[model samples]
Target: MQPSGTPSRRVSAFDIALALGGLLFIFLSAQNAGPAIAALRADGVQGTFTAQRLDCVEHPGHEQCSWVGDFRSDDAAVVREGIGFYGSERSTFTPGATSPAFDTGRLGHVYGPGGSNEWVIIAALLLVGLALTLRPLLRLRRPPRTPAPPPVPEHLP
Candidate 1:
């Protein structure tokens, strides 16, 4: 007779395959789709904005052009701007006193502080860590087994 309350052993290959496929999709999506999605969301933000595209007028640089964008509302105004990569050392732009202070900090770089390559490296590391942590969780399948085979008689009449 089977135990009164114990659950039966059930392992389905279909279920496992479905789960693995989902995990793979998630991993690939995080790697390839995350940045584009993030940019889309940022662009969706509602606020008064100004943007300008600039190129290195002075000297050659790693980056060709930079985009400066700012967001503003009744409550506050925030600047979302960065310098593009240039082959030269660095460039700075100073608007007049009437204008809000918006500095790119450095040239030949994305977002003024660090370059696009830096962000890419950081994002890649984060994804790697996420995958390592989630892989076991996604791959979890079975619990420990306790059942044993019954004894067989040596001689049969």
Candidate 2:
């Protein structure tokens, strides 16, 4: 018979390792989720800016006013004008004409960082963590699975 008051070594090293792994999964899931959300948010913001905003620029002595989305700013004057009004602008002017290198209107409304892909990855990781954490706990509480008792050995006559 076992002595009284001695602690039973019930938990195995494997179980503890699994718990640690599960925690790692939880941490990783959160980490991955963050960047994904940021990307999607950025995309959303860019989309909104693209759809809902406009820029305008005025050049000195220019015959016609060049507006945002106009041909593009090739000359320093047009570049300055764009910066004056829009706060910042990127332009690419080739021999023929100038054009915005980037669309600020589209850049302002991004909403997600990583989007659905990150969401799925994080969710799966979280689920894995939950499963890992629960499985051992459940097994620990469960009664020992044993075969039905065999008939008692025949007693001495």
| Model 2 alpha-carbon miss at residue 58, Å | 50
Give TM-scores for every candidate, taking all chains together and pairing residue i with residue i: 0.25, 0.44
lDDT of 2 by residue, 47-75 (tens): 11121123434578643322232312223
Model 2's TM-score against the true structure: 0.44
Question: Which candidate should be chosen as best, given lDDT against the real structure?
Answer: 2
Provide the overall lDDT of each model, using Cα atoms, as 2-decimal numbers. Answer: 0.40, 0.45
Look at candidate 1 and tell me the lDDT of residue 56: 40
Task: List runs of model 1 lying over 4 Å from the truth.
Answer: 5-7, 41-157
* Tens-place lDDT digits, model 1, residues 32-94: 454433333332222333334444444555444333444343246433443232222223432
Error of 2 at 147 (Å): 3.9
Output the number of the TM-score-best candidate.
Answer: 2
* Model 2 CA RMSD to the hidden true structure, in angstroms: 15.3
Model 1 TM-score, all chains together:
0.25
